[model samples]
Target: MCGIFAYLNYNVQKERRYILEVLFNGLRRLEYRGYDSSGICIDSDLSQPSIALDPAENGLADGSCKPLVFRQEGKILSLVRSVYDEADSTNLNLEASFSVHAGIAHTRWATHGVPSPRNSHPQSSGVGNEFLVVHNGIITNYEVLKETLIRHGFNFESDTDTEVIPKLAKFVFDEAKTEKGEQTVTFSQVVLEVMRHLEGAYALIFKSPHYPNELIACKRGSPLLLGVKELSEDANGGTSFHDSKFPTMDGQPKELFFSSDANALIEHTKKVLVIEDDEVVHLKDGSVSILKFDYNKAKNHGGLPRPASVQRALSVLEMEVEQIKKGNYEHFMQKEIHEQPESLTTTMRGRLICGDSSKAKSVLLGGLKDHLKTIRRSRRIVFIGCGTSYNAALAARPFLEELSGVPVTMELASDLLDRQGPIYREDTAVFVSQSGETADTLLALQYALENGALCVGITNTVGSAIARNTHCGVHINAGCEIGVASTKAYTSQIAVMAMMALAIGDDTISSQARREAVIDGLFGLPNKVREVLKLDDEMKDLAKLLMDEQSLLMFGRGYNYATALEGALKVKEVALMHSEGILAGEMKHGPLALVDETLPIIVIATHDACFSKQQSVIQQLHARKGRLIVMCSKGEGPLVCSNGSCRVIEVPQVEDCLQPVVNIVPLQLLSYHLTVLRGYNVDQPRNLAKSVTTQ
Candidate 1:
């Protein structure tokens, strides 16, 4: 995943320093998206003879005045340092070095090219760098397109598939001009020609000297949002762009902000228009226009995509700006772990209700209400996801199968695609992801859709790809999870899925007691989660004890198996340790060999059908002098621990199927503490991302 940010000030030129500062601030806020390299393009005023454009340090110099691109092969901070260093050596003001009207910046998660300055973004096209482009998502046909462009005498500098966009745009622009027998063609027409030839998903933003006042953004299958601010309106209703917060050389009241995430622009404006697929937006002349891109028909007509007669209304973001920040906690992961109590409450709000006994407890999930009956009647239900989301699906699988009497199967999205699995119209396929844009999950959803299975999406992100493409879905309103290792979203996903299972089987008389029990457990979950969070200090103490251990093992049976897997994952993901989750039943088969006094083995023997079996497993481990850490029901701690022979972590008892929601909390805390003890970056773990947008 990558983050794209752009700014356009209408009617006034901004100081280069102010522009860079704002752009850099936006990129820093979006660092949660994860990136390996970053770059920025500033439209410089070349008419000023005092401005010296260094060709080597910047990009290849164009004969005409054009945007200057500065890129680095590492973090966004490194790029900022490079820019500031260059400014110091040249004796130029950061604000005056490259004054411009518009600029674009990008934090890249490399997919098409190696993580290097040469392969970084702000890719340009044509001899004078006519178009400066930044893009997200993949161009599946880039290889063939690149070959064709090379045959047409185009040279390339980087190995990125994105480099082909500018070259192809230049080719199309020249071809259209030649056919029209004109000295110049409109930039919008050239964009249409380029869109017609491009294939696969992309969210692209570009600037061209031909249309210096405007910035063009187009997207299909990738997220992009346009934020608009009214510069003329302030507290006193003045018409000046220079606000007290942001000082500007030329006062202009109008600014347009664009980003892949809404969080980046929340400080500037809450009103945003989410760009839909195959839509091109032109932000210029203090206005925005939306155009629908259709290739073949548009080519035969006037080489223009159909312009939308009416613009889509702006949607105000419900989340507050402060929610994105990690406050009171050292890391976003810790904050999220502590936020599960409220997140689960929000996820169940208005859905799980406790009324009179005559009313009977029930769930009302709006997105899945009408589809529950169909799902209950389906031949089978397939739960699909990747990583933490996958563990969440596994956590919900048992509850779904037990309540609805529907066989449920769990599949890793990638593996499902690799096997070319069978899906039928009678099946109900459910896709779960924290960021609805998980690449493999989205691909799996497409495959299931093609097989005619009814698709359902359960994701934390609203308006994500899976949510839009699925027939029906639930948004697990866990708020924004900035941590790379998911904490709140997993519990929230399980909560939503548990509610789904409750809704599907509530009407059956035989299952009424079971369903009521689960509904009651769900009602108590938020408080139970709050109670579990109290173990934070204890978990930290335990983590300190285990920090020196080289390997760790977690054992569980029944519903808590998912908990064990997820807990182990959290530790391994953020703590950077070798951890494995093994079924207690499978321990005799092989895993028992690893158990010893030197290793830490966490066991989940919480009250369930398999509680007795797990207790036996713990006894066996203890006999072998294995370092035992037992998680069990509140009062049963003594029964499982036996005369304080082993360490114990206690959790309040809940319904059998719903135990996973509470059981996972302490493990999450342990992982967080372990990472902190080891002095690792808890929020952004190495080589992991909040969202996996690339397959």
Candidate 2:
């Protein structure tokens, strides 16, 4: 997974100086999507444009007219610092010189290359820096293309598939000029030709000195959206193909913005276009055009391609800006972890209702309201997702099965694709993801669609691929989760699925008592979450005790087994430690071998059908001289930890089926504090991304 952001100030207006800040802020917002390294390249007309370079390499001398480039091996903030530091050391006003109207910025999640400064994006295609490219998605046939380019005297500095793109552009540019016996070919012409050679999913943005006023972007698979800012009559008679209704800024009716996600541009503009597969977008000083790729048609029509006569509609963002910012919090993870109470409220608002006992408590989910009959009649209910989303679905499986009396199955989206899992028309498959753009989940949804299964999407992103493609769905409304390690989204997903189960159960009379109790529990979940948040100080204290442990194990049973797994995932993901979540029942099978006084194991013994069994698990672990942290009901702590030999974390009891929702809060806090205490990045952990957009 990766993020791409670009901007073009066509009017060369005074606001041009803010280009770097614009790109910098955009990348910071997109950081949750994923990145191992970051970089930016700005337009330059000077034969000697100055910019920061890798610390390992000697930066180009000022006055050498070339695109200014800045790169770093870590987060986007590191690159920002490098850019400012370079400005301080240089005689040239690098910031002022950086005001070239067009540029691209990238945050890379490595694929086909190692995570290093050399592999950072803003890859160059021409020796003179004629073409600079920033890309998202893979180039499957890059090796072959690289070999060919190498034979043509193209050299590579980074082991990246993206490097092939720029080199290939240069190759095409040279080949075309040679064939025509001419010295010049338009940038669009060369790009169009390069498109004929590319295969696989890619969203690309590039700029050339030969075409200084334009930023060209296109995509085949990875998501790309375009935002237009209108200009006033003084600027260029602001014209927007969609509507041109917004107030113009500084004479220019609009500047253009491009990103992998609309979240990146919410602060700039909400009016945007979602680029379709194989469509090319050209943004110039005053005009923007969307082009369709038709090589044969282009060849027959003097190398000029047809524009997409179909004007794609623009959509407004429903998300608020405050949701994406971390207010009065140290990190997004902490803020989001603490936001669970409100998040759960937003999730269940108007969905679960409470009244007189004889009135029959009920749940109403509009998205699934019509599909409940179909779902109840389904032969099987398959839950599909990846990473934390998958764990969320697993947590809700027991509730779905017990309440709806439906056979339920869980599948990791990637594994499902690999096995080509059977999905019959009689089955209902639910796709869950925080950001609906997850490539693997999308692919799995496609497979499920092809097999004729009824598809339901559960995600936070409103118009994402999964949300749009599925026949029915629910939005978790978790708000913008900026941390790479998911917290709120997972809980919100569980809440939404729990609501779905409750809604389906209401159709039958035998389940009335059980369903009503669950509805009451749902009504109180938000407050219960608030009470759980009180465990923060306690969790922090406990984190200090366990910070030095090399490995930790978590145990839970039935509905809570999923809680154990997700708890382990959060710990391992952010704390950078070895952690495992094991079914308490599975201990004697093999996990028992790992128990010892030096090893810390957390047991979820909250009141449930498996309470006694969990008590036995605690006894077994204690008998083995195992260090333990037991999570039990507030009052049952005395019952489960009667011997008073182990430390216990008490959580208020909710309906047994919804207990996992409450039980998980303390563990999430522990992981957060542990990650901070361990001196790790709690928000953006290494080797993890907020959304896993690629397989």
Candidate 3:
């Protein structure tokens, strides 16, 4: 939910206007990564270290933005535009006035305060707005900092941890501005100085009225980096870029990259140098250098997470509006949801997936062949992930364990980090992550890789951190899932995991059958998805029928039992209703107490070995007058037959291990439709940033 952009003079004589064009364009590229509102301050000629809360009006070469405290209690970007437009009716380009040197920009995903223009970033402080800054990550002890500042008679504006930076930097700048004026306590110095007094994670960049051309930047427990490159500059030498354009000037983007995902800077450079915690970087014209602010030796940490290859690949500076159009579909979400049936087939696209004895899967075990062999001979496997990704792993766990005949355990990555778990060289660690940038998941994978556990990654983005670091695994060939909630990717991963398990357990099938199943399913998928779409009309009615449900109880048995858990999660995430999932049998032990006409219960009765058990479970709920929605097996109408109160849905049947693969489709649809029914943005849920980069 946060975005960072840095601009430094690239070509010596490029107009500031061109640089601004590119900068604004880059910000637009970053919009998908949801932010409250964007705030920026550029050292253009019209304004020196001027702050634009919401950059409606462009900064100028000589003039700085007015120090107005914009406090609209609405969205970040929205309030920002109103403020920006109000700040100045005309958004005059100030790039030409000052020889632009370097600066940082931000589109904040607010973790603090409401999405108001006042709470926006590019926080400015000092006697006359001498110091300005933009920040990401949470400053945990902000209240304490706020109290201390108040004691010092320091005034504050926004209720954000970021505001402290500009004020604190200004304090230091004033204290050290006169002493050693040049190279001493500049805005960069103030940033480092203020950092000493703060606690928690942050990636920050600052500018000083005293020293306008140079930029001060640092990071700690948060993502930030120097592109170490140059870009087009205004006449005054100011550039709206941070990398050296020429390959040789590359010296590598001094890794302190602020990128949460590599897409931001892949176009600038692939070579990266990591910025360790407490590292201070001063980016100046014709020179890029690092200084030990506290004179403390930086810890040389090993096993630094490797950047993913896809993260390394840069897009063509813009997204295609056409790609998002859903082509022939009525809604983007619906089109994406339908694309899964084919997307899943595509994941198995290159591989041989014939589960039949006639044709076997062409199991391409990345670097895990030896590991898989060991696991085949060893004790067990641990499957882990977070959020929907965790559910994806949960869906694959039973199948992998059953097919491979190896006990597999699935847990959330966040859990493994907080608690010690059973991980051994004898046990293979299979982690599932969509972005591969998940911090906790990365740490969990690190613990496995660092220790001797064989780590396998089933990630969507090809070159993400987890993909690069794991002991080698498959890429869920579902290219670029832009919708943050993850549709096509979720199914593709389940497919890959299912196939991998089957291959490991029984590699006797011929490639032809595996390919046929995948191709047949794939070719039939768009149509199948179309058929599923036909159910949307029915699903919408279900949504309307279930509108009064304050809570839900769901259950499943066997391979898809996890789907019950996922179903409840979906309802909760979108519908904002309280729901719970447990085995139907477990209902008597506890959940049964919650069962009443008021608590609607959903049972995953999809045809599997557990159908009879699911029926018994359903009878118990039905007897108790528990409201129900039965997800029955495709052809088992007799098994699914319920009285007038319960609605029954018969979904397509696949292999037992692949039930989740097929069954989850309907649940995803149910979640999507219900969320729309609840009037929430299904794609970007409020307060949930797309990527959880910070712990």
Off by over 4 Å in 2: 45-66, 85-90, 94-100, 179-193, 231-252, 292-307, 353-360
Deviation in Å, model 3, residue 295 alpha carbon:
12
Number of the candidate with higher TM-score, 1 or 2: 1
- Counting clashing residue pairs in each candidate, in order, gives 4, 17, 63
- Order of the predicted models by lDDT, top scorer first: 1, 2, 3
What ordering of candidates by TM-score runs from best to worst?
1, 2, 3
In candidate 3 the C-alpha lDDT for residue 509 amounts to 41
Q: Which segments of model 1 are wrong by more than 4 Å?
A: 48-65, 91-100, 180-183, 233-253, 295-310
Candidate lDDT scores, in order, read 0.83, 0.82, 0.63
Lowest summed lDDT window (length 10), candidate 3: 303-312
Q: How many backbone clashes does candidate 2 have?
A: 17
Compute the lDDT of residue 695 as modeled in candidate 2: 58
lDDT value for model 2? 0.82
lDDT of 3 by residue, 461-539 (tens): 6556677677778888765554556677777777777667755765434434443454345434434544555576777
TM-score of each: 0.92, 0.90, 0.76
lDDT tens per residue, model 1, 610-663: 988998998899899988999999999889988687999999898888789899
- Whose TM-score is greatest here? 1
- Score candidate 1 by TM-score against the native: 0.92
